[model samples]
Target chain A: MPGDVNLWPKLTGGEVIDLLASLHGRLDRARKAELLERFDLDPTKRTRTCSKGNRHKVALVAALAGDVELLVLDEPTSGLDPLMELTFQQCITEAASGIANLVVTPPTLEELFVHHYDGAPARAGAASTSGGAR
Target chain B: MTTLTRSRESGPHAAPSSSTALTGTRRLLRFGLRRDRVRIPAWALSIGGLIAYFGAAIPAVYPDAAAMQTRAEIVRDPSGAFMTGPGYGLDDYTPGVMIANEVLGMIAVAVALMSILLVVRHTRAEEEAGRVDLVRAGAVGRRAPLTAALVLLLVANLAIAAVLLAAVLLAALLVNDLALPDSAAIAAGAAVVGLVLGSLAAVTAQLSEHARTASGTAGGLLGLAYVLRGVGDAAQPGGSTLSWMSPIGWAQQTRAFVDLRWWPLLVGVGVAALLLTASFGLVGHRDVGAGLLPARRGRPAASRDCSAPRV
Candidate 1:
C-alpha cells in the first residue's frame, strides 16, 4: 500500500482489513489477523461480495485500527446483527479504554428502548398495565 | 524508543499528533493501481499497438517522394486538414513527418481522453462512491487522493510512451526514411498532451459533485481544445498563432520530426502545473463529495407526467 489509493472496490476482506491496519499505521500483520479473526470475517472474499454484516465489520475493524485521536461514528453498527453488534461494542469498549477520544452518538431509542424478543415494547411504565389487544 | 513502544503496545492503535496528513499517500496510490490493473493495461496496449501500426503503415503508403507529395496535397485541402490539423511537414513530404501528421492529432485526442478518464475515475468517482471520506478519515492529506491520482497518471503516461517507443522502433527499418528522432517526438507529443489533459481533469474533478458531470466537463474541454486547434490549423494562412490558444495546439507545434521544437511543450507543462496547484487548493478548502458549484434545487412543485410511466 505504499502507492495505490484503494477505494477498494475489488479488495478482498483480508486485503481491506490489512489496508485498515496499515492506515492506522501500526501492528500491520498481527492486527490485521486479530481483527479479522475477532470479527469472524472471511479473508478471501471481496468487500463488495460481503454481506451487510460483513461490511459493517469491515468498517468497525478499520475504525478500531486507525491511529487517530478522535473517532466520530454515526450509527456505526446500523446494519449489523445482535451478535456482531455485541462484538463491535466490546471491541470499541476495549479500544477506547486506552487511547481513542470517542464522540459517539448514543444508540437510538428504537434499538435500546424496544425489545422485540419478548414480543412486547420495553416501556418501564407500561409493563405493569399491559393489556392484550387485537 | 520507550515512547514508541508505549504507543504501540499500550492501545488498539496510537496516533502521534505530529504525523503528517500525507502519511498514507503511497498506500492510496498502490490501491488505485490494483483497482485499475485491467483497464490501464487494455487502454495502453490498444493505443500503443495502434501507434505502432501507424508508424509502420504510413511509410509504406508513401514509398517515394512523388507519392508523399500527392498525399501532402490531399491533406492540405481544408476539408482533409480539419481532422488532422493542417498537416505539419507536408511541404517537406518526408515519411517521418507524414507519420506524425497522420497520427499525432488522433493520438493527442486519445491521450487526452485517457488522462481525463483516469483523473475523474480516481477523484470524482471515488468521492461519488463515498469512499473518499473513508480514506480521508485516516492519515491522508486533503490533497492526497488527487495527488495519488495525478502521480498514477504520470506512470500510466510513461507506460504509454514506452509501449509507443517500442512499437515504433520495432517497425524502424528506416523504410520511408523513418528515424528514431521522429518516432520519439511523436510519442513525446502524445505523452505531453496526456499530462495536459490529466491536469485539466484534476481541475474539473473539483468543479462537480457528480462523477458524470465531472467527466462530461473534462470531455467538453478536450473537445473544445481539439476544435479550436483544428480550425486554427486549417483556416490560418500559415501555421497561425490561433493554434497557441489551446493545449492540443501547443502539442502539435512540437512538430515532431519536422521542426522537433520542444518550446511549445512548456506551454502545456506550465498550464498543467497551474491547474494541479489550483485543484489542490480547491480540494483543501472545500468539503469532500461537494463541488465548488453547488447543485441547484429542482422546482418545488412537480408537473403532472401522464405521458411517461413511473418506475
Candidate 2:
C-alpha cells in the first residue's frame, strides 16, 4: 500500500477496489464491504471527487481486502483522521494476529558484515587480491 | 453482498510461470476503457463530426463546376498550399477532393493529438501519479500497461474510422457522390496517422518519468511535423523532402480523392512498428515509475532562508 494512493479518477472508489482485487486473482466481496464500512468510504463516489483522506481509505480497503501473505504499508496513516487511524491500528493488529507460524532467521556474522556495512574501508589495489582470497 | 472469491487461471504470482510479458493485458484493457468511457467518445465524435460537416458543407458551398473551379483556384494559392496539402484535384475540384486536400490535414492533427493524449494518459500519466505502481503490485505483467494503452489507442482510432466512413458514405448519398475507394482511403489515412503518432507517444512515454515531459515531447514532435509538412508543400508542387520527412506528410501524400494512392500510408505503418518495438525494448531496461532518461538531481543543501525556525 502506498502512502499517497493514486487511483483512476474516473472510477468510483468501489470500482477501483474491485479492479485491484480482481487483478490480484481474487475478489472477497464480504471482506471488501467490511473494509469499506470500517474505512467509512463511500464506494459510489469517483476518486477525482474524493478528498486526500478518502483516497487513502480507498487504497486501504483495496489492500486489506486482498489475501496476500504480506502487507507492506508505507506511511499508511499519513492522511487519515484520528478515529480512522485508530481503526487502521486495530485492523492491522487483528490481521497480524492471524499469522500463526511467523519465523525469523538470522544471517551469519561474516555474511552480515560483508553485505550490510555501508561505511566499510575502501582499500586500493584489491581487485587482483580478491580472486586469490576467494 | 455474497462473498465471491474468483481465482484467476493462474495464481497471484503467475507472471513467472507464464513467462509472457503481456499477462493481464485483457484486464488492463477493460479497466483502461472503462476509465476512458467518456473521453474516447468525445474525441471520436468531435473529429468525426468535423469530417462529416466538412464533407457535406464543402459541396454545398461550391455546387457547380465553375464555382468549384474558382474555389480550387483560391486553394491553389501559396497560403492554401501551406495550410492544406499539395493542392490535389484542383483542376477538377470535386467535393471529395476538396475535403481530402483541405480538411484532411486539420483532421489528422486532431487525430494525432487524440492518440498522443490517450497513450500518455494510460501509460506515463498513470505511472507518474503512482497509480501504476499499485497496479503492477498485482498479478499484472510488466508490459500490460503499455499494451493496454496501445490497444485503447487502436479502439479509439477505430471508432473514429467507423464514424468517418459512415459520414463519408452518408455525405456521398445525400450531398455529393464520391468514389467508394477514395472515401475508404480517407478513413484509412486518418486512422493510420493516429496510430503513427500514438505509437510515437508510447515511445516518448518510456523516455521520461514525468507525464508532462513525455506528452510535451510527443506534442512538440507533432507540431514540428505539421510545420515541416506546411513548409514543404508551400515551396513545392508535389511536396519536397521536408514534407516526406513528417508522418503528417506521409498521410497527406495518400491523396485520397485526387490521386488515390495507398503506398504513402505504408510509411506511417512501418514507422509506427519501429517505434513500438523500441518502446517495448525500453520498458524492460527501466524500473517501474522510472524513465530511460535520468531525472535532474536536486541541490544538496538548502539556502539560509530555509532555516527551521522560518516555519
Candidate 3:
C-alpha cells in the first residue's frame, strides 16, 4: 500500500490522476480539473519532480476525487496544512450521503475533554497516545 | 449495523465506463502503454532487427543455386531441423525460401518469448507489485487489465510483423530476387506466432500469483513446443503429423516460402482466440492478486532461513 505511491514515477501527474479518477466513477472532465486545481498540483509535472506533499495529493485526489461508495482512510491528513486538512474533512462531509467513511485516528485531548463517554465501545485506557489501541 | 459500501457491477457509481466487466479496458491499455514505452519497443526492435539481419545475410553468403544447395543439405540434418525450421524449402535452392528454412524456427521462438514476457510483465507483474489493486478498487472492471495487456501485445506483434515484412522484402530485392509473397508469408508467421504465445501467456498468468512463476509456466510450454516441433519436422521431412501438436510446429506448417499455406495461420488465430476466452473466464472467478491455484499458507514463525546466520 505504501509502496504504490512511487509507482511509475515517470508518469505525468495528469495521467496518474486520470487513471485513478476512472477507477471509482466517471465524473465529468470539469470536476477532475477542479479537483486538481484545488490540490494546487501541477498536472504536467512528472511525478518524480513533485514534492512529497504533492505526491500525497496525487494519491489523495485519486482516492477522494471519485464517487466511490466507501472512503477508508488511515492517517490521510498527516501531511496537509490546517486549512487543507479542513478542506479534506469538508470533502468527506459532502460525500456523507449514503457513503461510509472509516477514519482511523489516534485519540486527541480535545475529544477526551469536550465529549462525554458513558460506556463507549472503546475502553478509556485504550486511548493512550503513546501506544494507541489501533 | 451498516457495512462500508462495495460497488457492484451495477451500482449508483456505475456509469457507461464501469457498466461491464471490461469497461475500463481501453484506459488500462493506455496506462500500460505509457508505462512500457521503452520496454515494448526494445523487445519489438530486437526481434525485427534479427529478422532483417538474417534476411540480408543469407543471400550474401550463398551467391548461387549450387552454394544454396550445399547450404540446404547442411541444414537438412535432424540437428539442422531442430535449430532452424522443418527444412521445407531448403531443397528449393532459392535465397528467399532458404532464408525461411534457415531462420524461421529460431525467429518463431524469439517472438514467442517476446510475447510471453510482455504479457506476464503487464499482468501478473502488476498484480505482484500491488498496483492493480488500487486500479481495481476504482471504477475499473475485473477483466480490464488482462484484456488490455493482451490487446497491447496484439498490436505490438502486428507492428513487428509489418517491420519484418518490409525487412525481408527489401533484402530479397537487394539480392535481385524479389519474392514478395514469400516474404509476406514469413512475416505473417512471425506475427501469428507472437499472438499464439501472447494467448498462452494470458493463460499462464492465471495459473500462479507470482510473475516469475507465470513466466516459468509459459516459458516451459514454449520450450516444449520448440522441442516437439523440431522432432516432428526431423522425423517427417515434408511436414510432420507430430508438429501439429505444438504452436511452433503449426507455424512451421505455414511453409512461408515453400507453398504459403494459410490454413496453419488460421489455426493459430483460432487457438489464440480459444486461450484468450479461457483467460477471461478464469480471471472472473479468481480473486485479485491470486491465481487459479490457491496460495499455500506459510509457517507461523520463520524457519531455518529466518534465523540469523552463524557468526
Candidate 4:
C-alpha cells in the first residue's frame, strides 16, 4: 500500500506490490503473502476503496516489511487491535536494535517508555526536548 | 525496524517490477465521458433545438424576398444599426442568410460557454475533489488528466456540431424551402464558431483557480468577442477589423447561405487548436487544482459587509 492517500488514485494493487518489492526486496514477497493470507486481499478483484483502518494496515505493512533507516510513526498504533499493536511494537523494537532510529508517538507516556527504560515514565505534563530515556 | 536495517544493508534503491503501466489518459477519458454523457448531450440538444426553432420562425415573419429586404432595411436604419450591424447587406438578404447573421453571434457565445463549463468541471473539479492527485500518483503523467479532459470536450463539441447541423438543415428545409447544401453549410459554420468559443473557454478555465472564476472569465471574453464583432459588423471600412478579432466574427464572415465563404471557418478551427495547445502548456506548468493565477486570501476575521451591525 502506498503511504499517502493521495497516491491511491494512481496505484493499482500490482503497482503497489511492485513498489513495495522495490523498497524491501524479497521481504516484500513474504509480506504480500502474509497480507493476502491475513487480510484476504484478492489480486484479481478491483482495488478496493478501503476505510482508514484498512489504509493504516497497508501503511503499517509497508513500513514494517522494509529495512528502513528511519521510522517516524505518528500514532502508529491507532486502529490496530491488541494483537496487531504488539506485532507493531515488536517490529519497532527489532528495527531499533538493528540501528534504525524509531521515533514513535504513543498517546500515553507509560506506553512510550514501557519496558524500554529502567527509570520512571516521563511526567505527563512535562516539556522535555532532550529525547531523554525515562 | 528489521526491514529498514535489511534495506540499508542491501541497498537504498532496488529495481521495481517490470509490470505494464496503464495509460492514465485512457482511463480518465472513459471516466470523464461517463460523467458528462447526460449533461453534454442535454446542453447540445437544448441549444440546437432553440436555434432551429427560431430559424424556422424567421421565414414566416419575413415571408418573401421583399419582406426580407424590408426587414433588412429596418435593421440597417441608423437607430437599428446602432443596435444591430450596418444595413448595407439588407439588399442582399435571404431568409436563410438573415437568420444566420442575426443569431450566429449569440449561438457562438452559448456554444463557447458550454465548452468552458464542461472542460472546467472535468479538469479543475477533479483536482479540487482530490481525484487528480490520487490518479497522478499511480503511473500517470502530469498532463494526462488535462489532455483526457480536452479530448472528451472535443468529442462532445463534435457531437454538438453534428446535432446542430442536422437541426438547422431540417428546419431550413421545412420552413424556408432553402437549398440543402446552403442550409448544411450554414449549420456547419455555426458549429465551427461554437467549437472555437468552447476552446477559448477551455483555455481560460485552465488559467483560473476556481471553476466559477474560469466560467466568468470565459463568459466575459465571449461577451467582449460579441461586442467587438457586433460593432465591426455595423461599422464600415476598417471598423469591420474588430469582427476579424473575434471567433464569432469568423462564423459571421462565412456569410452562410448568402455567399457561403467556407474558408473563414478554418480560422475558427485554427484558433481552437491554438487555444487548446495553450491550455495543455498551462496545465504542465501548474500543480493540479491550482491555476496560473493565485487565489486571493481574505482577512481571517469577518468584515462589516459580511456581518451587519445589529441594533
Number of the predicted model whose lDDT against the real structure is largest:
2
List ranges where model 1 is wrong by over 4 Å.
A1-7, A66-68, A110-134, B1-17, B59-64, B172-176, B306-311
State which candidate has the highest DockQ.
3
Cα deviation at B186, candidate 1, in Å, is 1.5
lDDT winner between candidates 1 and 2:
2
* Per-model TM against the reference: 0.85, 0.84, 0.80, 0.66
Name the top TM-score candidate.
Answer: 1
TM-score of chain B of 4: 0.84
Could you give the TM-score of chain B for each candidate, in order? 0.89, 0.89, 0.89, 0.84
Q: Write the per-residue lDDT of candidate 4 for residues A11-84, one digit (tens) a residue.
A: 45545444443433334567566655554344433235655555555556555555545555556666667776
Ranking by lDDT: 2, 3, 1, 4
lDDT of 1 by residue, B1-311 (tens): 00000112344544477666466789889988887888888887888787667657765776678997998898888766767765777788776666667677787889889989998999999888877767776777777888889999898888888777766665555454557776776677788889988988888889888988998998998899888877887885234766678787877787776767788878888888888888888886667778888787787766667446587
- What TM-score did chain B of candidate 2 earn? 0.89
Worst 10 residues of 3 chain B by lDDT: B1-10
Q: Please give the interface root mean square deviation for model 2, in Å.
A: 16.9
Model 3 interface root-mean-square deviation = 9.8
Alpha-carbon runs more than 4 Å astray in model 3: A1-6, A26-45, A48-55, A67-70, A74-91, A94-134, B1-18, B297-311
Q: Residue B200 error for model 1, in Å?
A: 1.0
